[model samples]
Target: MTKEAGRGHALLVGAGILCSRLFGLVRQRVFSHYFGLSDAADIFSAALRVPNFLQNLFGEGVLSASFIPVYARLLAQHKQEEADRLAGAIAAALALIIAVIVALGVLATPYLLWAIAPGYTGEKRELTILIVRILFPGTGILVWSAWCLGILNSHHKFFLSYVAPVVWNLSMILTMLFFRHRDADRLIVYLAWGTVLGCLLQFLVQLGPVLKLVPGMRLKLDLHSLHVRQVGGSFLGVAIGRGVVQISAFIDQAIATLLGSGAIAGMTTASSINLLPVSLFGMAISASELPTLSRMAGDEWSADVATKLSARLNHGLERIAFFIVPSSMAFFALGNVVVAALYQSGAFTRKDSYYVWAILAGSGVGLLASTFGRLYASTYYAMRDTRTPLRFAIVRLVFTVALGLASALLLPRALDIPLQWGAVGLTASAGVAGWIEFHLLRRKLNKRIGATGVSVAMMVKLWSAAGLAVLVACMVEHYLPLYGPIVTAIFVLSTYGMVYFGVTYLMRIKVCVEVLGKMMRRIGIGG
Candidate 1:
């Protein structure tokens, strides 16, 4: 793929995901206004993770990592009929699977919650069960929506696939806006129903484009289809790989649940903020690059293909780092400002804001590695090698779970940290594991592609640039003229970005220089 294609498509996907995540931020604000970090919020956070398994199991990540490369290659070879058949088969299989899983999940909600969050008791447990049942069918609909996403993305229709989440986010926002009452419990019920409705709407919205791509599509059970079986086989390994990550989250929720009220909500809110940049940079870049890489991998192995793949992979890695390094710095330095600006209104007090920021800062430690690791995993996907990523993911998961337990369950008592800060410990442990994961991913790829990633010199440069940005931003946040948390944060961050871009350019950071030149040419500014 041309650098232009990779960058442009990433921008398209990024723009869509950015809007969805922005709406998601607004949704969080709505939640904060109504719920804050109450037991109700904790219930929602923990219960949401349960239904999310349905989404993650049959959702975008697995399909993107396993199904897309094969499907995209078929399209590239002009195998429209075969590709459509595979799509239909997968859809049918997913529907069947989701039907069974959802039924069992709804019925076994209490048992599932007991296992995952054993500490939840009485009303909290009851409320969590209620929400999980309400969310089950909706989560099933989302699995289908993810199937639609796989098809749309393979066709190079990136925007609608990612943007569809807006419907889901807005559903909850509207519920919080219009349906709220003095009864927070009743409001939680309304929010749960809204989630179900949004999932259906999101799925329907993507139907038009998906149907256009596969005009002759129809549901069929074809276990005999080679690609069908390949996907099924790949799905197992990929699902296990993805599941371990989910289990890590589950472990965190379970452990956090033991920490009493608001811990789960605190972690949830912090993670949502952390995911903002990851979705924009990491997921957007990988999703855009997947189709191109799949096409390249479909070709016969050659030195030419190896050279091109290595270049594209390295470029993606650097671009992700260019954005996420500063993101980590910002989170670590000015997280309180960010938390207050977005969520410190209404029931969300300043203390609560600081709590969420602590978790965010801990999560920031893994921002670069986690984002970059997604790209490296995609490289394995392109090679149709799901097993390798799974192995590495297993290793990472072991470390994460080990460190997460120590921090969440042991370290707080031992070190005399607050129980709430245990959430921070859980996140920090995961971040440390994320670096190890990325290292293994890059190492394996480099063994084949040869020295194909960010250099240590550039790593230092990125860190230095990010560190300087954080220093300036922190100082301005403290001393610069501003209105309140929101205004102060905006001013500090905008100044930080301007200073960072100017300095990176002056320091001959090619990523910033190229991006700056693009913006300048686009708006008829400096040449």
Candidate 2:
């Protein structure tokens, strides 16, 4: 794709992602109001861990990454018949697998909940199992929907896939609003059903355009196809990598469960907030750039491929550092106020805010690394070399688990840090892993693209500008009263954004200028 087209696609995806994230915040606010950081909320959130872990392992982790590129190749070769057959066979196999998994999940809900969150014993554990059983089916629906999304993405139909998450969030918000007061458990049930409904809607949203692109798209059961085998093999490694990541989460939660009642909820809530910016930039960039990268690889445009890949990677990293570094500083400075304003309305309290802030602080530190990791992983996948990332991912998992366990055992009493603080150690481990992965990926890209064309000086300027922006933001936050939490957060964010952009412009960073120029053009203000 041309640079302009790529930017346009990224913009659209970014806009859709922003919408989904905003609605998701609204949903979280509603949940906080109804349940606070109470045991009920913790149970509901904890119950989701196993199911979501499975979805990540199969859906986003393996299936989308492995399947989309191949599907794109088939479509590009004008092999619609073969492509449709592959999709059908994959869909049928996924369906059977999902059904079996769901059955197991439902049956094993009790043991799963105990294994993940052993801190809960009587009522909390029972309620968690109940919620897990209800929500377990969502995994299967989302897996099928992910396949459809991959199909849409391969066709460059990016808008619907981006918009689908917004629909899901909206559905959950409506459920929460209607059922929150009637029965707390009613809200949980509605949320579970809403998830399944949302996945179906998400799939349907993509299916319309996909059918138009590939006529005669039918659902058939053909496990013997060669295309199916290729997808299966590619997905196997991806699944293992994803499974390891999930195991890390399980370990994190298991440690939290052993810590205290509010530990799991606090960590989950904080992590969600941290993920907002990461998902907005990191995932969006990776998703938007993947097809282009894959196409370049397919066509064997080695030099062009490397140039574009480096440009995109640098742009993504600069964006992440620019936004996340200052955001993390601000989060640590104003976390309590931010949490209180957004979540302290109903069941949530000042104490809950305190716990959540601690988690958010740690997550903030990891935000840039997490965002960078997403882009790094995408680059490796685009090159069709999943094994390298998988190897790194294994090391990451081991580091995360070791740090989490050690922190839990040693840090709480010695440092007077609570058990919830284990998340901090986990985040630091992830950040280390991200740095390692980033360097490795960079070395690999350099080897392929040659050393002469690299742009080290530009990145240095970008990082310098980011540092200056953050310094200004810290000063502003310190001097300004900003009245309430809501006002303070808004003012701090606005000031930080303006200062960051202004400094980047003064530095004349190319990526910043390019992004700003696009924004100006979109607003009809550019020449």
Candidate 3:
């Protein structure tokens, strides 16, 4: 593909993901309005994580790594029949496995809660168990939704698949909106049911598109195909790697359980904001690049594969840094404004916003690393080398566990600080671990692909632009009279974005120029 096409694909994915993420934020805002940092909020957050464990293990990251390369290769080779069979077999197999797991998970909710939220006792513990059971089956359905995503993404139908989650978020938002008057405990249970319905809606919305794309698809577990076996083989390594990453998240949540009532909920809220850029820029670019990268891996590019791969990889890295640098800075420098804008209302207080901002600030420590790391990992997956990422993920888990324990459990007491501040520690320590894993992945990939990454000068330029943007945004925030959070965010963030892009445009950055050109064309101001 040409450079222009690649950027266009990334933009489509970003636009779709942005829509889904916006609705998700809206969902969270509604939830925060009703639930805030109450014990009920903690219970709902913890319960949600239990079932999401299954989704994460079986969902986008795992499927993209294991299935997309093989399936996309078949499509590239014009072997549509084989690709259809592979997709059918994998979907059927996943459905069967997830069914059994969801059943077992429902039965094991009491036991699972022991690890996920050991600090909860009596009513809190019982309520979490009930909600976890309520949520498990829905997550199973969402795993099927992810299967649809793999198919849609491989077919280059990027927008609908990414935007499908808007329905899910809308479902929950509507549920909360309808039942806003209920007590927190009852409302949360209703929200869980809404989530289940939303999950089903999310799956159905994507299924029609997937079916049209794969008209020859037949659902059966035909494990005999070589491509099928290859995907399964790759799946194991990627699953383990994804599981390692999820384990770090679970461990952090588990530790948060001990930090008092609001820590888990606060971290979840902060994470929602922290993940926006990761999904919008990092995931968007990486997801769009995967199939293209896989297609490039074929015999057509046998000669000069290294040259092409290195060029594409470096370009991806540069694109990721351009947006991510400012995003990370915003989280560190003006996170409270963001947190307030998105989440502060009703039951959620200004103090709550500050608390979440602290965690977002910690998250900023490795935001760029994590985003860059994702594209690197995607490159590894495109090469069909999954074990390297698995090994590095395990190393990250180790650091996360060790540092997480020290920072979250011990450091607060040592510093004579409130226990809740430990939630910030949890995020910051994880960021450090993310950087470590990033370096390892980049170092190894460089040896194989010949030194692929954003250049030193590009880094200097992006970071300098981001720093100035943050300064301008901060000044605007300080001088502007407090309108409501939303209006304030509009002005402050808009200024920040315009300054960043304007400065980069002045610096002759290619992406800024292209982006501005696209905008001007959309407005009929440019040819």
What TM-score would every model get versus the actual structure?
0.98, 0.92, 0.98
- Per-residue error (Å), model 3, residue 40: 0.7
What tens-digit string does per-residue lDDT give for candidate 2 at 222-305?
767777777787788778878877887788888878876677777777776777777777777778777776676674666776
**TM-score winner, 1 or 2:** 1
Lowest summed lDDT across 10 adjacent residues in model 2 is found at 450-459
- Model 1: weakest 10-residue lDDT segment is 297-306
Residues 277-296, candidate 3: write the lDDT tens digits. 99999999999999898877
Number of the top-ranking candidate, with lDDT as the measure: 3
lDDT (CA) per prediction: 0.89, 0.73, 0.92
Candidate no. 3 TM-score = 0.98
User: Residue 441 of model 2: what lDDT?
Assistant: 58
**Candidate 3 residue pairs in backbone clash:** none
lDDT of 1 by residue, 1-527 (tens): 68888898999899999999999999999998788999889988888889998789779999888889889988988999999999999999998999999999999998898878898888878988999999999999998998998999898889999999999999989988888764888888889999899999999999988998997678998999989988888898889999888887787788898987899999989988999999999999999999899898775888777888898898998898889888999898889889999999888999999999999999998989899989888888888788888988889889998999998889889988777789998999999999999899988888877678888888889889888887888888778776888888889889889988877888898889889889989999986
